[model samples]
Target: MLYFEDLTPGRRFETASHTLTQDEIISFARQFDPQPFHTDPEAAKTSVFDGLAASGWHTSSLTMRLITASELKNVANGLIGMGIKDMRWPQPTRVGDTLRATIEVLAQKASGSKPGFGVVQLRWTTLNQHDEIAMQLETSIWVARRPTEQA
Candidate 1:
């Protein structure tokens, strides 16, 4: 179980790879973004992508799934996402692309109002098979601190 004390600034964690499929990309985009480049291959050929691509939101969701399945699920007190900042999708995610995520602790501070919790700022970077960054985001989360031992 990971506690707030376990996550120090500069610490990094990685998750297993996930391969993107055309069906899944189209399905996700159809349900959420429904953009031409994300939903239709022929249409995407005329767009800037030149091919069907996963929606930015879909990429973020995939990143979250990897983090939760491989990392966050091990947290002792769990985590509550506070907010996100500076989110960007630098490269398009296409079918057959295998993606992985790296999470780095940027900063952390014990909550003044909530002694039992701490606020942790993290930078999440998702990379494709070519190791090109597909997405990046800064997020803040509340993590429970380990109980202090009494003397």
Candidate 2:
């Protein structure tokens, strides 16, 4: 299993490409986030975004997959979520735009209060096949560290 020691600051990890489907987008939006831009394409066209766009939550969920496939799950410290900080959807993700995620480790600090755990801050950026950035996220997660005995 991967451990906290395995995470290197400034390191980056990427995920396989995936295309967002219109049906899937509508499905998710209909349930969790029902907004004009997310649920109705014609309304979205008249709205500012031009067409149907995925919710930020949906984008976040996709980002998690990239992290999981990157083996972050194995390295997490009980998988504690610290919440997102800055998030921006620069470009609307269309149904056919192939999407990929990349994560860059920004910081790693052993928690002073939580023994045997470390806090990791990362920037997760999602891009399309054309190399255009679609979403930007700042995520903070806890990672289990090697016990003192092992260290």
- Strongest candidate by lDDT: 1
Model 1 bad stretches (over 4 Å): 149-151
Instruction: State the displacement of the C-alpha of residue 90, model 1, in Å, after optimal TM-score superposition.
Output: 0.6
lDDT by residue for model 2 (1-151), tens: 6566776799887778778899988898999999989999889888778788888778777767766776556664555678888898888887887888888889889889977788888898999889998889898888888765644
Q: Model 2 compared with the native: what TM-score? A: 0.89
Q: Candidate 1 at 77: error in angstroms? A: 2.8
Model 1: residue 150 alpha-carbon error in angstroms:
6.6
The weakest ten consecutive residues by lDDT in model 1 span 70-79
Off by over 4 Å in 2: 76-78, 148-151
Which lDDT value does model 1 have at 27? 99
